[model samples]
Target: MRKIVHIDMDAFYASVEQRDDPSLRGRPVVVAWRGKRSVVCAASYEARRFGVRSAMPAITAERLCPEAVFVPPDFGRYKAVSRQVREIFLRHTDLVEPLSLDEAYLDVTRNKTGLPTATRVAKTIRQQIRDETQLNASAGVAPAKFLAKIASDWKKPNGLFVIQPHEVLDFLAPLSVARIPGVGKVMEAKLARYGIRSVGDLRSWDIFELERRFGRYGLRLHELAHGIDHSEVKPDRPVQSISAEDTFDIDRFRDELGPAIRQLAEKAWQATRKTERLARTVVLKLKTDQFKIYTRSITPGDSINNVDEVSALALLLLQRVELPADTRYRLVGVGLSNFYEPGQLGGQTELFGNEF
Candidate 1:
């Protein structure tokens, strides 16, 4: 069994705000744009106590905690801190897979420091992060990625937990089905209809029966109920897509997206050029104020030429949105995908072109 560790920074954006501004310490802090359509980026534990949360509208958050201090997100500073934390992880193991700016998975089964166990590595890394950045990180050590991810979140705000191979089943049993990753509100409701409320309940059902109901996911459910996950901590995965997006301070009508689309396309074009890979497709994405998502993609007859083309294509796709008249959107995004390394660019795949 491999020894995996999941490290998650606690209330990352909000914590950084509090750390930088001592006055915000121990007070409800929300990182968000201040407007009717703006959504919370991160909420401190103090803010969460008043029901404020990430993605909640700023208006709702204001109603929840009138005294909550709001600060705009500073991604540049967060990315810098993330790099420092990653350097600390590299001291122990090279098998690091970052999930976001605030969390990552490390396969420390064979660590460079010659640590006797994964728990020691987790503790040492957490302490180093605290000492270097003055921020708290929680850790979870387990034999598999799934278990490690769950264990890391078991305790929050400077806590650590472990899940031994022998205790896997015992640890998974009796827990709510929602504890499983990917079991969102919709999936939980679907499982509830079949009287499956816990991991134990899931295990009691026949594997074939699960497959019959949930298809491929049902087999995954059976394995997870028994605490089995074979996925590895993949490091240095190739870039499959490059994207940039913006959320408007106020919801926008269809006619208002041209400028945003052009801006995002320029941002995406610049971002993609920084990589060794070239894009073969363009994608347009939009999200309504009600959270409805829509994506339109085109592979085109050839690879993208410039930002102007991307803007034109994105605008064309915008016209294809089949929503009702006068529908409003809160977010717009543009991206490039179907990437091929520069060395692989001149290939027969260009003749037929790929469809996204």
Candidate 2:
């Protein structure tokens, strides 16, 4: 069994703010942008007690936690701290998979520190992050990614949990099906129809029957139910797509959509530069005032590079949208897909698509 550890920063953005400003410590903090359309990027544990959460609209978060202090996101500083944390991971193992600035998976089966176990490696990494960044991190060590991710959350805000391979099934059985990877609200509802609400309930179903009902995902459900996840931790997993989107406070007319599209395209381009791959498809996503979502995409003969080129291409895609006249849009997104690694660009042929 491969030994994997998941490390997640606790209230990352809020913690950073508190670390920089002494007065902010021990207070409820919400990290978010200001303005009508703004959504929270993170919430402190104190703010969470009032039911505020990340991704909640800033306005709603304010309503939920009237006393919460709002702070704007600082990706630059967050990225710097993230780099420091990653350096700590590299000290233990080369197989580090960063899920985001605040979280990562490390395969420490052959750790460099000569730690006797993955749990000890996780403890060392957490301590280093605390000692260096003055921030809290949660850790989980397990035989697989899904379990490790779940275990990481078992204890929050500076905690560590471990799942031995021999105890996997017992640990998973009583948990809600919602705890399973990829089993979201929709999947949970579908599973509920079959009287399957927990991992134990899911284990009773036949794999063939599950495959018949849920298709490929059903096979995965069966494997997870049996506490089996064969997937390995992939380091620096290849980038498939880079995207950025905005929600407008007021509905925007079609002719008024240029500014939003351009902004999102620039943001997406900045994200694209972080990857070693090139993008061939320029995609435009929009949501109408009625909440109807639509996407338009094109694979140009040339890979996308600059902001002007991508923004212009995305604007052209808007002309192709055949929404009824007077249909105002509430959101706009810019994305680049169909990625090709540098070496593969020589004979570059497009693969279907993948989600990042």
Candidate 3:
């Protein structure tokens, strides 16, 4: 059986804020803007007691908890801490796949640190993160990524849970059908209407009947309900594309557009740097207040070398959007696509000083 470990930091952003600022510890904290158009990005456990949650509007969050402390996100500091946690992960296994800034999957079947079990490796990594960054982490160890991910969330902040091969079925059977990935609120309600609440209920459905009702996802749900996930831990996953997106508090000024594009380019560059590939196409994504999405892309003559090139290409694409300066926007994003390895082309040297 394959050994996979999922590590997820507890209340990542809010935890970091509390760790850095001693005064904020143990108090209800919400990391978000205190503006009319802003939404909560993350809420500490204390804040969650008052029904505060991520993505909820700031006004609603205030109504839920009048005493809640609100703080804006600091991506730079969070990225630095994420890197520190990544370094801790690297010490044990090279087969690390980061799902986001605060969560990742590590295949430690044969670890570099000579760890005997995946659980041991998880314990050591969690301890190291706490020692180095003063942050708490939760971990789950199982034979597959899906189970490991769910196990990790079994217990909150500073918890470690393991699902051995023998216990997989029993552990999964009692869980709600909504625990399966991709089964959102709508699907859960649909399942509930049929008196199917848990994985056990899903197991009672015939495969053909599930396929008839829900199509391809039904098959996946059937397999997941039985604790079967065949996905492998890919150590050398290739980068298909690089992108950056931001949801603005409000529409930005036309003159202020340059700064926002530059900022997004920097973010895209940072995201691309995590991979070992070069991109030839740059794409810009814009979303208006009405939720209409628009995209424009250009394949540059040469591979994009730095943030400056990305910014320039993005600005050029922005001109294609017919919207006027006063057009209110809800979101903006920049991306790089059409990737290739640096040495894949004959004698094509690195175009820019930036290396992925």
Candidate-wise lDDT, in order: 0.83, 0.84, 0.82
Best by lDDT: 2
Off by over 4 Å in 2: 242-282, 285-294, 298-319, 323-356
Alpha carbon deviation, residue 60, candidate 2 (Å):
1.0
Over the stretch 1-356, how does candidate 2's per-residue lDDT look in tens digits? 78989999999878999999998999999987665456677899999999998756678899998898988777668777777888888899988887666788888888899988898899999999999989999999999999999999999979999999889999999999999999987799999999999899999999999999999999999999988998887787666678988888899999999877876776686565444467889999999999999999998888777778889999999999998879999989999998887656621111100000
Put down candidate 1 lDDT per residue, 16-104, tens digits, no spaces: 88998999999999988687645677899999999998767777999999999999877667767777888898899888876666778
Candidate 3 per-residue C-alpha lDDT over 164-268 given as tens digits, one digit per residue, 9 for 90 to 100: 988988998889998999998779999999889999999999988899999998899899988899987755355677787877887765456766676677667
- Candidate 2 lDDT at 276 equals 44
The candidate that achieves the highest TM-score relative to the unseen native structure: 2
Name the 10 consecutive residues with the lowest summed lDDT in model 1: 347-356
Structural similarity to truth (TM-score) of each candidate = 0.75, 0.78, 0.70
For model 3, the local distance difference test gives 0.82
Ranking 1 against 2 by TM-score, winner: 2
